[model samples]
Target: MKNEIIPYILANYPDLQTTKELLIHCHKLGIKYVELGIPFSDPSADGPVIQNAATKACINFNFDNLLAILLDLKKQNINLEITIMTYANPLYIYGISNFYTNFSSANVKGLLVPDIPFEERKVLTRKNHSIKNVWMISDNLPSASLKKIVSNSNFYLYLVAYLGTTGKNIQQSDSLKSTIAQVKKIKDIPVAIGFGIKDKNDVTNILNIADGAIIGTSLIIELDKSLNSAKEFLNNIIL
Candidate 1:
């Protein structure tokens, strides 16, 4: 199977229309997965690029509207697997049960709650939600902790490439390679590395070790230029 190239887009960043259009473009490009970031007041895991975009997106973000965008894409037969990435606070305010109901109804495939620790994930999973939980693992995790996280991972494992927030340059160290190897040994789940994955070269390097590469900050930067620019950038990296 071809390695996955998942692009992360902030919901209603520039606007809802553009967000929808970008999803359509991604589908056309043969990209099966897209991370739709829900704007939050405090995005702890996000770097400045995505953080700034989220700040702007929050200005007019409507949770219902975001769901509607997904529903609309479904209506159009766009089958991009959307994983909603957000903090735990927003999920709490929205009510966890209600959040899962709406997202599952809209056909969301996965959920990535970065701020929630492994132990606290039960707070989100207690309801037996249909949407798969995407767990995050980093290079610094202890072997036992990593094993636990990998064993519990539902859809896939999101491996943080570096120790910092998103948008920094990835180092592709031996520790990262060792982490991926360890996860593979623990479980057979697909591991997708993010945080500092910038361009085609970055994606290419990641594909050498992991199952996928998630582009966020760099793609967001291209999107800031134009949708066409974003398309071009993705085209170069996706293969």
Candidate 2:
């Protein structure tokens, strides 16, 4: 709820130390909220950039490592809100109650589970409303169900800007515009849009309607290319 301008982290940083460092850097850049991926063997909804991040994470990272990264943020006194983007299998393995408990204990504000459905959320919601259980509503989600999901979400709704796995794309669709207009009609909760938002111009276009923007692949690509330059660009990205 605290002005969620999420900049996604691939979570597959070259090393844990570097990941922590990058998080610290982002915090310094005045990022209000961050959604970091929990690397899994198969990141089905991810595109090439996220897939590569997951691959690297699997080879060098684990849940404990990710937990350490979060804990490190706490240690650094970074007050930015945190959300974990991951698949459901890991949560099931961790036990939904225990996973929620752990995340709440770590000061995580929310979660983004692409695979979880509204009916399934009822199961987790009972035990975990303490932490924001965020949900996604694509262009495909029915109007009734989307309203239900948004009403249920404690965190602001996450609206995917472009469909097909998270990747770079040019031009917003008429579908996306209608969806935003529809969501605006339903509720006043913060609505943050993501997937392929590349630069300041993208944010400018989205901010007129959306409460905030979530950017990832572009920043990661930039970071992968040059950290310093990426940081400079990030610093320049106004709300």
The prediction achieving the highest lDDT against the true structure is 1
In candidate 1, stretches whose alpha carbon ends up further than 4 angstroms from where it belongs are none
Q: Any idea what lDDT model 1 has?
A: 0.87
Cα lDDT computed for each candidate against the true fold: 0.87, 0.75
Q: Residues 115-163, candidate 1: write the lDDT tens digits.
A: 9878787788755678988989898888898988889886898999988
| Least accurate 10 contiguous residues by lDDT in model 1 | 120-129
Which residue pairs show collisions in model 2?
A: none
What lDDT tens digits, residue by residue, belong to model 2 across residues 1-239?
A: 43345788767665676567667888887777888777777888889987887777767666666776687678768877888888888777767777676667665888888888777876566443467777787788899988787766667888888668887673667777787778767876778888878888887777766777888888778877767766776787843
Model 1 lDDT at residue 13? 77
Output the lDDT of residue 128, model 2. 30
TM-score of 1: 0.96
Q: All candidates: CA RMSD in angstroms?
A: 1.3, 2.2
Candidate 2 wrong stretches, greater than 4 Å? 1-4, 126-129
